[model samples]
Target: DAGITQSPRHKVTETGTPVTLRCHQTENHRYMYWYRQDPGHGLRLIHYSYGVKDTDKGEVSDGYSVSRSKTEDFLLTLESATSSQTSVYFCAISEGLAGGTQYFGPGTRLLVL
Candidate 1:
């Protein structure tokens, strides 16, 4: 995905600890999203933003939270890291319409030990 960067903010964290990952896009797309990938499960949506400060939880949003104070940044935070949350995280960007093409950033692997 162009103009997208998924930060591996933390490679490892202890269980019960809080973890925060970041995704940044320079394409000025109006829609940003977060997804997690596991072995058996495909990429599952976590949260998404349609604009600055306009965000909604996705399928796997129970133990996670998101904040998009700026259009260029989308922050995903795990309230408390757990082994179950260990997986590769991705950030995607979409053009004007969310139904349009989407550009995905590099996956950031987060390991909760």
Candidate 2:
């Protein structure tokens, strides 16, 4: 309800390819985060941006990268797709993490074979 969306709700691809996921928001929140969901890890942070052009890597940023050039848009890119990278990706936005409130996008399901 706040304002968030993710592109390519479902995708299937061979390994070693490149993939890019897009996240958009209309609420203009100050913080945006990218996360990957796996069976054991639950949701692990991949990257986050606190402001336009101000971004940082997170725990699961090894095979991923993110950029936030505008207040309403954030993009996540996978340099090279891998079977291990097959997972559900979620985009979230919040005023800040301290408040324990975040709006999540529908999510992208990517598969590599």
Candidate 3:
């Protein structure tokens, strides 16, 4: 009954290093999203994909990138790890953009030291 799942639930890295997180969904939704959660900023979108290989950047996508090769798999990569990038990353899935209900994964906790 799992709808979505994220790999490497917990990660610890150093500054200037590269990091990648994986999100997998069994719901077969058309839309996938990557978001980061911080104490003050709340949940911010990093990137999202409308369809396979069709992705776009979000408001806070400066240092993050995303790729969706298949309908059920989405990957988020941080070009270089930074202390400011340390947060809980979440993956969401939706059926459509207009009024779709997004389902979130458990979340990946990343620490950049």
Candidate 4:
């Protein structure tokens, strides 16, 4: 992807603890998203924002929240990190592509202890 950065490339947290991951983009795209990748789940959207302060929940949004107050930044927060949430977190952006093609960031690996 032309514009994407995920912070805390790797993390290990305890269960019931809170965690927040940052996603930064330089493309100034209007659509930003957060997804988690696992062996079986593949890539599942947590949330997405179409514009500043305009966001919506996705299929796997439970326990997660997102914020996009600027064109170049989007954030994902996990209220309480659980073992089940241990996966690679990725940030994505749609450069207004049709057919729902999205560009993804490297990813952040989170482990719940």
Clashing pairs in 2: none
| Candidate 2 lDDT trough over 10 residues, lowest sum | 95-104
Q: Taking the tens digit of each residue's C-alpha lDDT, what string does model 1 give over 1-113?
A: 38998787448889999988999999989999999999989999999999999999888999999999999999999989999999999999998786668899988999999
Count steric clashes of candidate 2: 0
Residue 24 lDDT, candidate 1, scale 0-100: 92
What TM-score goes with each of the models? 0.95, 0.94, 0.95, 0.93
| Residue range 1-113, candidate 3, lDDT tens digits | 45899999999999999999999999889999999999989999989999999998887999998888899999999999999999999999988782358889999999999
Q: Which parts of model 3 are misplaced by more than 4 Å?
A: none
CA RMSD, predictions in order: 1.2, 1.2, 1.2, 1.4
Rank candidates by TM-score, best first: 3, 1, 2, 4
Clashes of each: 0, 0, 0, 0
* lDDT (Cα atoms) of all candidates against the true structure: 0.91, 0.91, 0.92, 0.89
Cα RMSD for predicted model 3: 1.2
